[model samples]
Target: MATLIGREIHLASRPTGWPTPDNFSLVEAPVPAVGPGQVLVRNRFLSVDPYMRGRMNDVKSYVPPFRVGEAMEGGAVGEVVDPGDSALSRGDLVLHQSGWREYAVLDAERTSALPPVPGLSPSVYLGALGMPGLTAYVGLLDIAGMQPGDQVFVSSAAGAVGSLAGQIARLRGASRVIGSAGTAAKVAYVRDLGFDAAFDYHDGPVSQALAQAAPDGIDVYFDNVGGDHLAAAISRLRRNGRAALCGAIAGYNAETPVPGPANLALVITKRLTLRGFIITDHRDRMPDFIKEMSGWLREGNVRFNETYVDGIEHAVDAFLGVFQGTNTGKMIVRLD
Candidate 1:
């Protein structure tokens, strides 16, 4: 075979606040050779997620920060082109963590063979069927300890994770599910996803919106947006309410510390249980999540949407779009 070349996006500079186009650079390079026990893959899709925003900084966190000059990595799905002394065969579909690049060479063990799901693209593994889906599953079912007939509220309801969180609550027998989004269209989209109520946060105070949406108060809160939304949820949480604290995208790009919700005192008075979680810590649940979520997708009980931006050259644009709320569901970059 002729020599293969690939392009990857590198973090050119760490941004102080919100990242700009200048923070990333697309560079051409030769695809690395596959060593023994390794495999070469041609990535088909790349995921751009809200959590990645935090990785751009040099601060210490659950995961290491992305190096300034290295290819930024996330979720990706690809096909094996060369299986060098590995069990994987050519053309095998797999999921890995070498995104932001067109090709990857890694130990075979680093790639998980992807089973074909009829009527769904392999890219679904990066969104509704992948990390985001598992995040929702663990956060709602385990962290929040959601029970049947619980009235639920999810912030940033139209986001990749939040969207799934809301739908999962409804499918799991929540008596009522309310959501908050950033736009009128997103609010409507959330409602279409079967949320009992969804409101655009820009319409009025988030507190008032929550009060109106769940007049009887909520039994559970799936927190994707913090700040004001957290405060509002605290006030509206019924006594003994449970909250699964997921991503706080509302402050991911803040230059200064984002203030804590003013109604935190209410947590004590209302006997609320608020627990934050990192999805990676709950990988034990992946098997159960995949089995249940796959059935839901196949039965049409749950649905997912993707906004695609073609080409690796535009991966940065896709990443930036997440903060702009430009995607109704998962935002993906197509490299094929």
Candidate 2:
């Protein structure tokens, strides 16, 4: 056997505002040897998400910031090349948090074996069957306390989490599902995903868009892009409405603080429940999420889209594309 040289994207510098290509560097290094209780994996798919932008900043948050000169981490699915002495076997597919790299050496316990889903690619574990999927499920079902026949609205509905959030609300018996996207094509895509209404936020004020989409007021709001969207949802939430404050991509790259919803007083007037959540804190719900989502996928009750950018070298571009709305669904990098 010969040595394996792998490439990984390192955070070269902290961005002051929106990150540029200069903020990342692709470096080649020897794949580390698997030691006891560890496994060597060759990553096949890497995820690029909006939340990762926040990790590039030097800030204290739910997750630690990505360190300069170090490989950034996110969700990845790979095949185990060496299982060392662990229960996992060579050639087994696994999911771990060692992304932004072509290969990873991980603790056996830290990596979860990915069972084969008939007719689905392992990359699905990186998207709909993975963290984003779980985030949508937990936020909408648990945090928001969504109920049947609820009129639900999801922002950034064309992105990975929001797309699934809107669909999950529909599948869970919401009477009406509305969404907002950044582009006309995305709005059409959201409508195709079963949203009763979807509008391009670029068309006009977000508040006006939400008004036309849900005239009677929304019973639940799954907020992925905050800022203006938050204010819009706050203004339209009915009494007792609940909001699952997921990611605020709108403020991820802000150099200074982004303003909060101006209509925040509506939270008081309507007695709405607005809660922010970190998906890591809801792992206990994964079992239920996987069980239900897997069934949905198998039965074709749920649909997902992924935009693949080939090669480890383009991973940073894929990451940046999320904020630019270059992807209609999950942005993924396919490593060779």
TM-scores for all candidates: the values are: 0.98, 0.97
Instruction: Give the clashing pairs for model 2.
Output: none
* Model 1 lDDT, residue 288, Cα: 98
> Which digits, one per residue and each the tens of the lDDT, describe model 1 over residues 198-261?
9999999999989999999999999998899989999999999999999888899899998898
* Per-residue accuracy of model 2 over 1-336 as CA lDDT, tens digit each: 688899999999999999999999999988987789999999999988888887887888788999999999998998998889899888999988899999999999877788999988789998898889999999999999999999999999999999999999999999999999999999999999889999999999999989999999999999998899999999999999999999888888888898787787888889999999999999999899999999999999999999999999889888889889999888889986
Pairs in clash, predicted candidate 1: none
lDDT, residue 61, model 1: 94
